[model samples]
Target: MLIASSRPLAAAFDLALVDLDGVAYRGPEPIDHAASSLMAARASGMQLLFVTNNASREPESVATQLSTLGIPAEPDEVMTAAQAAAAVLTRRLAPGARVLVVGGAGLLTAVRAAGFEVVGSAEDKPEAVVQGFAPELGWRELAEAAYAVQRGAWHVVSNLDLTLPNERGLAPGNGSLVAVVRAATGVTPVSAGKPEPTMFTLGAQRAGAHRPLVIGDRLDTDLAGARAAGYPGLHVFTGVSSARDAVLATPDERPSFLGADLRALLVAHRAPERSGDGWWVCGAAAARVVDGRLDLRPEGDRTTTLDLVRAACGAAWEAVDTGSALDPGSIPDLAVHEA
Candidate 1:
């Protein structure tokens, strides 16, 4: 492993597996400082890989989306739940094994490309039933999957995430699909995505790194996945999770490190100060020290001093999104003195 003197803990890690939707970008917009944080990590000699449980898109398409958001990434650096499911099946089952696929084209393509013979219909009584996110899933598909699984075929699912974040809001994801099949077949599927060791193992193998860090916004998937893989994780609050959630997280779902945003975490590795007298601001929200206490402003407001601090934090985070360094000027009316 490459070693650095000042940041020993950071240097110990050689690889980073980050989440896409909630951690880096939400819907079409990239999270503030998402790109810069990744670029900084890359410069620090950490190999970056985007591991996502969203099985809706292909790897190349995911790469393109990241690039469009000003994030420098490659297809090889992206691994989706669909790809993981395919890898598991390819390694375990024989070549050209007849399989029933109940999901979108991404899962079907991955499985087929991995040498599995995918059957649209279960008429052939396939050797396996692979389930993933299918927006148009109907009763017929569920029945077929149950039939195939009941026949002794291996049951596999891309992920168990109950929902996925989109522009409109959270929507039913692969986990919901797996639930339907499970209810029908009375069998639990082998999960191949986040919180499952399969994806982490596959990603680490591909990146060829001994020590890897998992970064994301959600504690359940990203942090849980890292825990399952025995790796450290950096939790950012730019997505689904809030500071309140962190405070109340169960032992297994808590993150190793928590940050307001990716850039802020990279700048300082200190844990958030939590005391009865202190005010708590989640992520990039605004806060000001008054009477030995912090008064935090709500998100998307820029009128008060707290709002200004929030805006400053937002600007600094935006700079990171564009792969730039954090500038003190980005946060207005704040004095910075070297300790």
Candidate 2:
């Protein structure tokens, strides 16, 4: 039996179901300090699972992307809405049950991997119909899904996100597809993502976490998922969410901790200082302080800071490297300082 916490934000829960796209990365660029934040959480002995509502990509692919972005992750560390949908069908249907999949390869792969037989055509007459976001969705596919549902096949959908963000802008998401299927069949498919408990349960079980902290940038999915899973979450403003959104969010959709970016959060957690002009190491990043200047640098990135103390330290280090006497006035202002 799952127990609900009276003070959910403060309560130390056993697992975290973190979203990927809008939470950790936006397009191909990793959100600022995303790698460090995960490293910090892992260092604190928190189990982490990367959960996503995007059913377009498989878990292995998602893991590969995370690894390329300098984050240590494996295929098993990732969870997608398609996986949740597959679990639902696998638990409800008999092994080798025929399933009509109308989505991307991710959904199809998960369904087949779960021991379900995929039907190529409506004439195949599946026992279940699974729907997700498919850019190639045509009228024929919609009609086929509707027809399958009408024939008493169980219906399942990956997520209900009305729009998915991309570098171009918001585009039609799984929710739009769900609406089409619902209008045609008059059947609301079971949602398997975000604000749904099944994804969190599966994530926690796989991660084997006793206490976790959810982190994300979207209020609707990541924050909602954390609340539904009864875990505390940290919200970063570097993605889809804004400071205004955080202030106006409902209790369930609001995060327990808020930060401008992932780096700011790590700085606050590790080297919190009031008055100082020195360098402080936080995870793999080194924050330096020079004569009224500050600089921040991650392991592989150039060192720069906005804080005066960190800037001074960086300047002194540069002087030492060139075998020149440290002159505070001669040090140039760090170019990478940002609020």
Candidate 3:
């Protein structure tokens, strides 16, 4: 069930650990309302840390892109999975340990900065292998990773996200490439990105935030990471997951709040209330699952579509939790449509 906050999210939380790829921008373009909403949240005294799973680019590059997209960002305020992976390696390996670098310049930069001797080939007898994502990565790089892993070098990956949202559509993420290496080597690389809690914890610690909110579009990586880090998450509809996905989310993937976009941070959230007649109500929107079918009724014209979505998710989640199997066909298309 979604949690209610009497105060606006920007006021309630000290910092927002925000995901970059799908929530703020997809590839080179900015998502609608993202920049302005984040600016407003900053005005309300909430700090922002752009936490990203995309480990290809360095922090300075990411910050430059965000500034170009109308969101002012500093390099120090951006945390990349590459940085986390480097940190994870530093904890286990000695300084100047030879590391077989896979992926792109970002991974190389982080490893070098962490006092690791970066090597290009498995024949170097590197102490470990560090892999991240890069658009140009192909068979040659993956093969090197596989070889190193098979030779008993420690394996560490930036993230395990299977798909990355780009301007065209979802593309194979680092996780897909990691899977290729794992298949050949028969060894699972240690993940240091989302769903592991490292990035979120690092962001919160840097921001000095006691009450941090994780905001992202993906349920599996973003929301799941938030749960593992002992923080609440806010899922927005601007990316991969949809309203239908939210209703069917597993217990660990559920968010504390739902919104159409980053703009929701400026408003208060009201949780759906379960009525005596088995209906879940949010404002004037009501929904229920009866005989495996979800029924949604907007009681009045004033009912917002997002509230209707909230109500539906509440009803569906309750039904699923109580041993009632919902018909997948019964779930309505609750995607937010822009005029």
Candidate 4:
């Protein structure tokens, strides 16, 4: 089981490596309580680093968008997967080496900043290929990456996220795009984003934080990545994941802390307790399996909806890990409307 902290995360950790999209905002709209809680966290002496898997834009552009969303940010405070990919590539290639750029200007700029010459095609005899995502990414760019990788240029992909949220809906992410090149070239590129520790390490390094908390909305990328990086991460119910997902999360993907929003950072975490045949949380909700069916019920003292969420997750994770059946119908209404 993940341990709880005595103090709130904002005060317990020196820095927070926050993921964008679902955590801070959805498309162009800012998430509820994200701005004010973050502002409070900063005032309480916690450093903030906006870590994004979207490499389509540069750091300055990302920071600008955050400011527009009411979250204060600066270029140096943002970390991009593109930068992580370039750092890995730079360590292997010689300075001024020719690197074929396959995605957006961000990837090119990062590679160039790392002292490499950015090229556009295999005809340039590039030494390596760096790829990311951009709306304008075309078949021509992917073809260039395939040709370069097939010709033996070392390949690197900034991220492997299969989907990214846009104004319309879910769209193919850089991971999905990278698959095309991989299929054509019969080669795989080294990934530098979530589920890999490189980006988190770089963010912590930049913030000079020895104990940094990873804050995100997705379990697969953010929470899973934090576990892979050997750091504790907090789960905010403002994005793709819900309390139900948390209850069914694999052992490795479980988050250390659960919060309704960024505001939870200001309050200390209270862990659930193991009761007779189940788990109880916040003295309001309890969960247990009876007759091969999961049973979640409220006690006399009712608390906030998050208490039930916490109880359900604690019992569900325990049951799953213990080889118990968790039928869908067995779970009651565990949704919390306030995020």
Best by lDDT: 3
lDDT by residue for model 1 (1-339), tens: 001123533465788788888778998987777888777777877788989987767788889999888787888999889899998887679998998988887787788888988897667878888888868777888888888898888998889999888778888777877787888778988988888877788899999988787778887888778788887777677777665454334456666665566663354343322235434333445443443222345456433322233323333333344455543332333321111
What digit string (tens of lDDT, one per residue) describes model 2 on residues 124-180?
989989888878888889889988888888899889998888767778888998898
In order of appearance, the predictions have TM-scores of 0.76, 0.72, 0.97, 0.94
Give Cα-based local distance difference scores for all models.
0.70, 0.70, 0.92, 0.85
Task: Assess candidate 4 and give its TM-score to the true structure.
Answer: 0.94
Worst 10 residues of 2 by lDDT: 1-10
For residue 300, model 4's alpha carbon misses the true position, in angstroms, by: 5.1
lDDT for model 2: 0.70
Error of 1 at 120 (Å): 1.4
Number of the top candidate by TM-score?
3
Superior by TM-score: candidate 1 or candidate 4: 4
Q: What alpha-carbon RMSD in Å does predicted model 4 have with respect to the real structure?
A: 2.0
Q: 1 or 2, which is superior by lDDT? A: 1
Quote the lDDT for 298 in model 1. Answer: 47
- Backbone clash tally (model 3): 0
User: In model 3, which regions exceed 4 Å deviation?
Assistant: 301-304, 337-339
lDDT of 3 by residue, 47-73 (tens): 999999988999999999999999999
